[model samples]
Target: MNKIVQIDPDQVEDVGPLYAARKKVYPQKVSGTFRRIKWGLMAFCLGIYYFLPFVRWNRGLAAPDQAVLIDLPNSRFYFFFIELWPQEVYYFTGLLILAAITLFLMNSVGGRIWCGYLCPQTVWTDLFYAVERLVEGDRRERMKKDASAHRWTLERISEFVLKHSIWLMIAWWTGGAWVLYFTDAPTLVKELVTFQAPAIAYIWIAILTATTYLLAGFMREQVCVYMCPWPRIQAALTDEWALNVTYRYDRGEKRMSVKKANDLRALGQHAGDCVDCYQCVAVCPVGIDIRNGPQLDCIQCGLCIDACDNVMKKINRPTRLIGYDNDINIQRRIEGKAPIYRIVRPRTIIYAALIALVGGIMLYTLATRSLLDINVLHDRNPVAVKLSDGSIRNAYTVRFLNKRGFDRVVAIDIDGPQDAKLHVVGGDSITPDRPMIVLGRDGTTELRVLVTAPSDRNPEKSIPVKFRVTDIGLGEVASATDNFVAP
Candidate 1:
C-alpha cells in the first residue's frame, strides 16, 4: 500500500523555486607540481604548433621544397621525404586506429588526461584563463571588481582592450600558421605579407580566426561542459582502477577550522585534516567542487589538487588531499590496506600491443611503398568486336602514374591470350606484345589500347588481363588487372 499526503504548490513557494541563478566562479592561481606540468605541456604543444611549419624537409629538386604539405591542388600529401597519393588513403585509416588505441591506453592509466591537459579546447581555455587572471587579478579581487562599479573604470577598460587585442593576435597567428602547412611556408609567408596570397587562404584565415577567438575568448568552459561529447564517452570508457583527480574525503571530511582541529587533537578526539578553506573550489576552471566526486563538469585539470596541497603545506598537515587516486586504492585505504597502483594491467597491455603492431605495419609499408602505379579499365559498352580476319578485338583505357619529380620512360606489357597482339591507338608497342610509353613525373598518362587475338584461344565470356608498368631507369614496377571480353 502507498500513501499520498497532500498537494501544496504554495507551500513549496516559501522554500524557494527548484532552480536558482548560477554563481560565477573566479579561480585563484597556485604553483605546484601539477601546475608546473601544465606549463611544460603547454609550452611543448604551442611551440610545435606555432613553429613546426618553419622546419624544412628535402625531397630533392622534383618536389615542393617544404618539409610538410597537404598539396590539395596537386592531390598529394608530402611529409618530409615521404609522399602519398590519393590511392594511399588507407594510411589515414591506420593512423586513426592507432590514435583511438592510444586514447584507450591513456584512459586506462589516467582518466580523461587528454580532456584535462591536452585537448585543444582545454589548452586554449587554460591559456585564456591565464590571460584573464593576469589582466583582472585572481579570484577574490576579480569577484569584487565584477560586483563593484570598478568594472567599468578607464583602467579596467584599458586592461580589457589590451587583453582582447593580444587574444585576437594569437588567434590570427594560429590561423596564419595553418595555411603554411598547405603550401611552401617561406613562399606563403612572403605572399601573405604582400596580400598576394590566394583568396581562399585569406577566407580560411578569417574563418579560423573568428572561430578561435569566439571559442577560447568568449565561449570558454561552455564548450567543455555542454558542447563536447568526449566527457560522456570517456566516462563510459573509464574503469574503477584508473587514476582520476579526486578529493580524498577519508582524510578530509568533517570539516572544521585548523585551530578547532588542533584543539580536538589535544583532547584525543579524532579530527579530519581539512580546514574548510574552499581553496579547491576556488581554483577549478570549470567551477566544480572536487568533494562531490567525479562529475561530468569537472575537467580534471588538477588545479584543485594544487590548491589543496598548498593549504595542507601551510597548515602543517600531509598533502594530496586532492590527488590522482583510483577507487580501488580509496577503498583499500578505507580498509586500512596500503594503496597500490597497476598501470600495466591487461587492458593497457593489449592497447599498447595493438598500437605497436599497427604503427609498425604502417611504417614498413610507407618505407617500401612503390613510386609508380597503373590502372586499367576495359571498355564496358562494346565489350569486344569481331575482327575482319576471324579474330577478336578488345579495347581498354589504361592510366599510368609516375610519382617521381621528372619525366620517365615506362614500358607496358599484357599477358593473357595466345597470339594476341597489343597496340596503343596513338602509341607504340616495343614488340608485338609489349607497349612502350613515356610518363611525366608527378603526372599521369592515359592511352586507348587495343588487343586482338585469334578467335580459337580466346575464352567465350571473359579472361583476366594484367597490364604491367615497368620504370626503365629505377626498375620500379606497378600493375593493375582487368578482363578482356569476347562474344
Candidate 2:
C-alpha cells in the first residue's frame, strides 16, 4: 500500500534561467614576478610570430630560399632542412599527436599554463591591455573615466582615437606577417607595400586584421571564457595535484580591514592575513574574485598573485596570500599536514612515455624514409591488347619520384609473365632488356609503359606484375605492383 503525498505550489524549487548578462572588465596594471614573466613570454612569442618568416635557408637554386614556406602551387612544404611532399602528410598527423600529448602533459603538471602564459589570445590581449594602459591610464583612472557620464572630453576623444589607430596598425601588421609564410617574405613585403600583391593576399590580410582587432581589442577575455574549448577541456583534464592560481583561503579567511586586523592581533585574537582588499580582483583580466574559490573563468594567469604580493608588501604582511597552489596542498594545510607533490605520477608518466614513443617513431621513420617512390596504374578501358606479332600486351601508367637534388637515369623493369619485355612509350631502352628514362631532381615524372609477352606463354587471365624503377647511379630501387591481363 502506498500513501499519496501533496506539496504546496509555493514550496516548489525554482531553477534559475540559463543565460547571464555580460560584465565589462577593466583590469588594473600591476608589476611583480608573474607580470615580468608575462612580459618576457609576450615578447618572445610575438617576436617569433612576426619575424620568423623572414629568415632564409639555402636550399639550392631549384628551391625557395625561405626557411619556412608552404608552396601551394608546387604542392610542397619546406621547413628549414625538411621538405615534405603532399604524399607525406602523415608527418603533420604525427606533429598534431605530439602537440596534443604535450598539452595534456602541461595540464597535468600545471593547470592551463598554456592558456595563461602562452596562448595567442592571452598574449595579444595582454599586449592590447598594455597599449590601453599607456594611452588612457591604470585601473582607477580608466574606471573613473568610464563611469563618468560626460567622457567625451577632447583629451579622452584624442586618446581613444590614438589607441585605436595603434591597435589597427598592429592588427594589420599581424595579418600581413601571416601571408609572408606562403611565399618569399621580402618579396611579399615589397609587393604589399607597393600595393601590387595578389588580391587574395589583401583579402586574407583584411580578414585577419579584423579578427585580430576584434578579438584582442574588443573580445579580450571573452575568447578564453566563452569561445575557446580549451578552458572546458582543461577543466576536465585538471587533477588535484596540478598547480593553479589559487587563493590561500586558509590564511585569508576572517577578512577585515587592516585597522580591524591589527587591533584583533593586538588583542591576541585570531586574525587572518587578508585585509579584505580587492587588489586580487582589481588586477584580474577576467574580473572574477579569487576568494570565491576556483571558477572556470579563471585562466590561472598568476597576475592576481602579483597584485596580492604587492598589497601584502605595502601592508607589511607575508606575501603569497594568493599564489600557485593545488587543492590537495590547500587541504593538507587545513589538516595541519605537510603538502606532497607527485609530478611523476601515473598519468604524467603515461603521457610522457607515449610522447617519447611517438616522437622516436617519427624520427626513425623520417631518417630512414625512402628518397625515391613509384606508383603504377594498370589501364582498365582496354586492359590488354592483341599485338601484331601475336604477343599479349598490357598497358600501364607509371609515375616516378626523384627525391634527390640532381638528375639521374632511372631504369624500369617488369617482373611477371614469362619472358615479358617492358617499353616506355617514348624511350629507347638503355639495354635490350630494360627501358630507361631521365628523372629530374626533386621532381615527379609520369610515363606510359607497355608490357608484352608471347601469346602462347600467357597465363589464363591475369598475372601479378611488378614495376621496378632503379636509380642507375645511386643503385636505389622503388617498386609498384599491378596485374598484367591477357587479351
Candidate 3:
C-alpha cells in the first residue's frame, strides 16, 4: 500500500517562463574603420554574385560559352578552360577540404571573422538596415514611431509600403541572378522578362526570393545566432590567443559620468575611460554588449570598437577602449607586462601547410589529367563461351570518352590470353587486333566488343585483361583492367 502525497501551491516556487520573448534590436548607424571595410566588402561580394554569370569564355562551337556553367543535361561542369565530368567529382571533394581548412586557419587567426565581414547573412542584413534607416529614419526615430500612439499614420504607412516594395525587388533580383548561372545569362534574362523561361527556373527563383527576403529583410541576426552551425564550431576551434572583438575592461573599469571621470582624474583618483555610454550596444547589429566579455552572440564584427572610439574621441579620452584583442593581452595589462601576438602559432602553421599540400596536389593532378578515358564492363550472364571451332569468346561493353571539343578517332586494344583477337561487333578495325571507333566531341561512345582466343590458350582460372584506348591523332592514352574468366 502506498500513501498519496500532495504538494501545496503556496509551497511551490515559480521558476518564471521557460522561454524569453525576443527583444527587437534597432542598431544605430556609425562610421569608422570597420564600417568602411564592411561597406567595401559588401559591394565587392554583391557585384561578383550579381554579374559573374554574364562573363563569357569561348570553348569552341559545340561547347558552352558561359565562363562558369553547370551543364546538368550533359553531365558536365565548365569553369573557364576546365571541364569536369561526373567521374571527376573528386575535384569537388578536394575543393571542399580546401575550404574547410581555410576556414579553420581564419578562425585560428581571428575569431568569427568570416561571420562578421564575409557572411551572406551579414552583408544582406547590413543592406536591409541601410534601407530601413533611409526610409524610417535612424534608430531612435524608428523606435519612437513604433511606440507612438498613431502607429499607422498615412505618411508612415506610405513609407512602410515603399520600403517593403524595394526589399521585394532586391530579393527577386537576387533570386533571378542565381538562375542565370544555369543557362546563358543574356538569353535567359530575355526569356525571363518575356515569361518564356523554363518552369523549373521560375520555381527556383521563387524559392530563393522567398528565402532571401525572409532571411535578410526580416530574420536578420536571428539566422546567425540560431540557424547557423559555424558559431558552435568556431567556439570549439578558437584558442585563447585568437584576436576577437573585446572590451578592454582593465582600462574601462570603475565606470562613471564623463564629467565625473574628469574630476576624479584631476584629483589623482583612477577613473576608467568609459563614461557608461550605451553607444556600443546601440551600434551592434546583434545587440551584444562587448563590455560583458565575449559571448556566443558576438560575431566579432568590430562595430562596437567604432562606436566606442567615437564616444572616447568626443570625451577627450584615449580610443581603443574596445578593439580586436586577445585574453592574453588583457591579463598582461593587469600584470604590468607587454602583450604579445603569436599569429604564426603551431595550429596556424599546420593549417597553412595542409592547405598548401592539398592545393598543390589538386593543381598537379588537374594539369596532368587525361582527356581521353575508357571503362570496360564484362558480360555477367555468360562470362565465357567455347565456340564450335574450339575458340573461347568473352563479351565486354567498352566505353570511350572524348573530352575534347572536336570529334576524335580512338583505337581500342586488348592485352590478355595468348592468341586472342579483339573485334567490335559493329565497328571497323584499322588492324586485325585493334578496332577503331569514332568518338563524338565532348561525349562518350559505347561499343560491344568480343575477345576470342584459341581454346588451348584459354587459362583454367580467371586472368587480368587490360583494355587500352589511344587517341589516333594526339596519341593520348587511358586504360582499365577487367578479369577474363573461363566457363
- Candidate achieving the largest TM-score: 3
Instruction: State the RMSD for candidate 2.
Output: 3.7
lDDT of 3 at 124: 88
How far is 411's C-alpha from truth in model 2 (Å)? 1.4
RMSD of candidate 1 to the true fold?
Answer: 3.7
Whole-model lDDT, model 3: 0.91
TM-score each candidate.
Answer: 0.92, 0.94, 0.97
Compared with the true structure, what per-residue lDDT tens digits does model 3 show for residues 203-288? 99999999999999888888988999999999999999899998999999989998898899899999988888899999999988
Candidate 1, lDDT over the whole model: 0.85
lDDT leader? 3
Prediction RMSDs, each to the true structure:
3.7, 3.7, 1.4
**Residue 34 of model 1, lDDT score:** 85
**lDDT per model vs. reference:** 0.85, 0.90, 0.91
Model 1 lDDT tens row, 88-125 = 99999998999999998898898888888899887877
Candidate 2 backbone collisions, by pair:
none
Order of candidate numbers by TM-score, starting with the best? 3, 2, 1
